[model samples]
Target: MKFSRQILSSSFSLDKVPGWTCPWCDKSAVSGKKDDFRIIESVQSKSQHSHPEWEPFRITGTFCGTLICSDENCGEQVVVSGLMEVEERGWCDEGEYFSSYEEILTPLFFVPAIKLFNIGNNIPIAIKDAILETFSAFWQDLSTAGNKIRKVCELIMNDKKIVKTYIDKNGKRKEYSLHTRIDFFGKLKKGEREQKAYGLLMAIKWIGNSSSHVNNSLTKADIINGLEMLHHILELLYDKDYMRIYKLGREYNKKKGPLKHPLFGTRHL
Candidate 1:
C-alpha cells in the first residue's frame, strides 16, 4: 500500500473540528491547539493464506490522521484516513494473496471495523515493510509445517500402494497383475483425527483465519497465546522435547518472572 499525503492539513484546533477523535486510546481530547500537528497517511496490503507454493502480495491503502503528543508519557494521537479491504480476489504486484473471489466479495468495511483492528499507533519507519514482515514470517513457518505433513502423507500412500507388471507372449510367455485385497496400513494406523500430523496441519488453518480476516475476532493477547500453543503442539507432533520452552522457563524461574503458565512457569522466549 502507498500514501498520497504526509501532512494532511495544518493541524486545526480541536474546537474547529467537529467529530475528530484519537485512534489510539479512543479518547476525545482537545483537538484544536497551538502545536506542531499534521495529518499523515499510509497504504498497504494484507494476505490470508500462507501456502508455501503460492506467492504473497501487498495491499495499498491510506491511514491518515494527526500526531498529537510527541512525548512518550502523553503519547496520544488522532488519525482519519481512507482504507480499502485487503482485496481477496485481485492480482497484486507485491504478492500473491489477491484471488478471484475478492472481485465478487464486498470490499472490506474500513471505518469502525478498522479502528478495532490494531494498526499499531507507534508509526514505525516502514509501515508496509513491518506488516509484510509479520505476515511473511508466519507464512514461512506454516509452509514448513505443511511441507513436512505432505511428505508424510506421500510416504504413507506409496508404502501402501500395490505395484503390478506384465510381459508379452512373444515366446509363449505371459505375466499377471499384482493386486492387494486390503489396505494393510489402514489396519496398522489409527484414525485420521487421532493422528498428531493431521492435528498440527489443522491448527495452521486456524492461525491463518485469525490473522487474515478483519473481523476484530483475535486480540493481541490471543495471538500470542495461540502462537505459544502452536509451538508446543508442533513440538509434540515432532515427538521431540521442547528445548526452547525449557531453556526460557529456566531463565524466567531464576528471575522471578511476573506472568506464569502451568508448564513454562513464567519466562518465555
Candidate 2:
C-alpha cells in the first residue's frame, strides 16, 4: 500500500490537522484534539521576547499532543511531539489582503509509531522486526532509520536462503555485501517478478548505502521512497494473492480471452 506523502511530510496545524495512520489498525486515521496540544516556548525564544523588535515569526517552541484513531472500534491512541514555529500567513478579505502569524508543528517523534505501509503476515519475523524498527526510528533519526532499512535487506536475503558467505577461488570464504546478495538473488530466480524485485531491491540498497555514510544527508522523503519500494518488494515476495492475480493476467493476455478450466469450462473474462 502506498502511504499519503502529503500527510507524512506536511506540518501539523490546529486549524487544519493532518490525519495520521493508526499503527494498530492501519485502516483508520488518527486526528488530534485541539485541547490536547500543549505548546511550551523555548528558553531562547522566551529570552528574545524581551527584545524591542521581537516579531511573532521569530517565536519558536516545542509541542506535544495526543491523536486518537477515528475508527470507534479501534480507538487506538498515539502520542506525538514536535517543534512548533510561527510563520506568516496571508488572507484576502473583500480584495484586501491581511497577514497574520500562525503556529505550525513539525513532528519529530511519535509513540507507538504510525504505519508507513501494510506488512504482510507471510513476511519473516526477522524482516518484520527490522521494518518496525525502521518505522520507530524514522521521525527521530533518519540515518538510523536508513540503517534499519539496510538491515531489512539482509534479513530478506536470509529469508530467501541467499548465501551471506561463499568460498572464493583463493580458498577463502568472503562475506557477500547486500548489493552482491541482491544481485545473486536475481541471478538464481527467473521470472518477471524476480526482475522487478531485483530492481526495487537495488534502489533500496543504494539508499541504505548512502545512509551508512558518517555525514549522510538522508531526508524523510528519501526514507519514505525506500519504504515504498520495500512495500512493493514485500508484496512481490509474500503476497500470494498478488502472484495469483499476476499469473491470471498473463494467461488472459496470452489467450486474449477468459481462461478455461477443465471441470468448470470457460470462465468469464
Candidate 3:
C-alpha cells in the first residue's frame, strides 16, 4: 500500500475527485469537466516493432492526460498518465485496419477509491484523534492500522470503569474492576445490563492480539471491519441518548425517569 503521494482528505477536494472518499464528510461525489481535460501530446507517438508472429506492426506509445474538476467548491486538479497498446479489434476509418490503440490508465494516487468513512463529529476530541489515526494507518498499512485500533480499544477501557460484584460461597460480598476488553465483557452474566455485544467485543480483542504479533499480515478488510465494530462500541457507549429524537422520546416517557430508561433516554437537556 505504499504510494508515491500521501493523499489526505484535506489535500484534495474530497467529493469532486473520483475514486476518493472523505473520511470526514462521509459523502461521495465524483465529476470532472470534459473541457478541462486534455492529453499530453508531446510525450505520445507511434512506433514500429517486429513481433515473433507478425512481420512488422506499429504500436501506440505512452501518453499523459490532465483532468481539472470544475465543481467551483471542489475544483481539484489531477493528472492521468498511462501507456497505450495496439488492440486487435480497434480500427482507423480512413485505413482498412482491424486494430486500434487503447490506452491503459496508470496509477491514480489521488483518486476517490482511497476514501474512508467519516467517524462523525460528536465524539470526544481524544477519541476522534485515535479514530482518525487508525484510518490514516489503514491507508498506509493494514497491520499498522490494526495496531491503532488496539490503541483505541485500550483507550475505551481506560476511560470507562465497570464494576463486577458477586456473593462469595462463605457469604461475603466482593467487587472487582474490569480493566481490559475481555475483563469488561467477562464480568457480566448472560443478559446482564452491563454486558455489551459479545461478538463485537471479542473481535476487538482478537484484532488487538493478532496485531501485536509480529508475524501477522493484516488485511484492509479486517482492519476496516474492526474499526467499524469499535465505532459501534463508541456509539452505544457515549454517542447515543443525546440526539433530538432520543430527547423527544425521553420527554414522552417522563414516567421512566433517568434511572429507569435502559437507553438513558430519561434525561432532559
lDDT of 3: 0.51
| TM-score of structure candidate 1 | 0.21
Considering TM-score, where higher is better, how would the candidates rank from best to worst? 2, 3, 1
- Assess candidate 2 and give its lDDT: 0.86
User: lDDT, candidate 2, residue 96?
Assistant: 100
List candidate 2 stretches off by more than 4 Å.
91-97, 168-172, 251-269
TM-score of each: 0.21, 0.89, 0.49
TM-score of 2: 0.89
Superposed model 1: Cα runs more than 4 Å off:
1-204, 239-269
| Model 3 bad stretches (over 4 Å) | 1-19, 23-71, 74-115, 162-179, 185-194, 241-269
- Tens digits of per-residue lDDT for model 2 on 80-164? 9989999999999999999998899998888888777778889888889889889888878888988889889889889989989
lDDT of 1 by residue, 95-186 (tens): 65545421111111112211211232332334323333332232124333233333332332344342222356565444321112113333
Per-residue accuracy of model 3 over 41-103 as CA lDDT, tens digit each: 222232223334542123444434444444446655445444333334455676766653433
